[model samples]
Target: MKKILLLLNICIFILGKEIHAQTNFPYYQDIQEFKKKDSLKFPPKNGILFIGSSTFTKWKDVQAYFPGYSIINRGFGGSTLLDEIRYVPDIVYPYHPRQVIIYCGDNDFAFSDTVTSADVLNRFKILFELIRKEYPAIPVDYISIKYSPSREKLWNKMKSANRLISNYLKTQIHAEYIDIDPVMLDANKKINKSLYLDDMLHMKPEGYRLWEKVIKPYLIKD
Candidate 1:
């Protein structure tokens, strides 16, 4: 009887810890915007859902980029993979998207002093598993971390994470690793300054156009 009681206590403790972790998410305001948008008019089902950090959040013209395709952008600026994992039920599962294109992990390394490429990959694995558990076989496209001029210092770490994720996706049945690194590079194989805005962290129109060209081929037509 005492052993059973101890097991129950352990389970409860773990559950509590998870709940606390989720509740402490820093992007509550950003998530609230999504909720507000849904309350006004629920997004369509089976459309392409894009969720990530600033790169995606600032893409206000995403629909214009992909003509004749239903797309929903749920990106929140400055968010990490952990944020996406916490809010998947709120933002991802409800949409019933035909495909999911995620462009995160940039801020993950930017914000953390000690985070490594392996840590980024593991966080991605957690997010991937969460989606797979609910929607088996649905295509999930992972947009590789772009080689940005502003975050140039972290380029190696970002590249390592992208390579790890790309290799891992090859082993999954319905996963794709979209590498847009080359598209943003110059003839000398360096990050093209022309692709980004003044901040150099986020892409400019030319940059997003490059992305559209690369990603359009992967989109599923109606």
Candidate 2:
């Protein structure tokens, strides 16, 4: 009886630790809000899952952009690839998505100068492998990190990370690297300020419209 009680205590301790860790995590409230919404009425399975950073989270009308396709946007606060990996079970696993679209990694460079391009690439590979492990047949697309006017200095690092990820995806099956940079650039090959909001980091509706044109063809049709 004592042995059984000890085992039960251990299990409870481990569960408590997990809850504590989750609460301490960045954007924990956002994750809980997602759970709250899911509990209310879960999104339909087999939809396109967009999991990433503020770029996607700020896209409140992502579903409207892709009228026919069902989009599940699980993006939270300015999340990095590491954050995405940490919350994979919460965001990626629950849904049986037909396709997964990712847009992250730029924050890693912007947030910390110590984080190299290779670091971002490695983080992406980890996230990709996690998804592929569960859903090998489902198409996984990485939307190349865009050049935000606010993070102009990090553009070189972003470009490097983008190239690395793009090349890696080329070798993997059912993976595509969608480049939206060209469309976002102007005559001088700089990010168009008009597409972004006053902050110059997040996009306006016009930016999303541009993204729609590029991303539409790649989406899987039912």
- The estimated TM-scores of all candidates read 0.89, 0.90
Write the residue-wise lDDT of candidate 1 on 121-191 in tens digits: 87788788878888997899999998778888998999999999999999998899999988988999877
Going through the candidates in order, what is the number of backbone clashes in each? 0, 0
User: How well does model 2 score by local distance difference test?
Assistant: 0.87
Tell me which residue pairs clash in candidate 1.
none
Shift of residue 119 alpha carbon in model 1, Å: 0.5
| CA lDDT, every model vs. true structure | 0.85, 0.87
Minimal lDDT window, size 10, model 1: 5-14
Candidate 2 lDDT for residue 100: 98
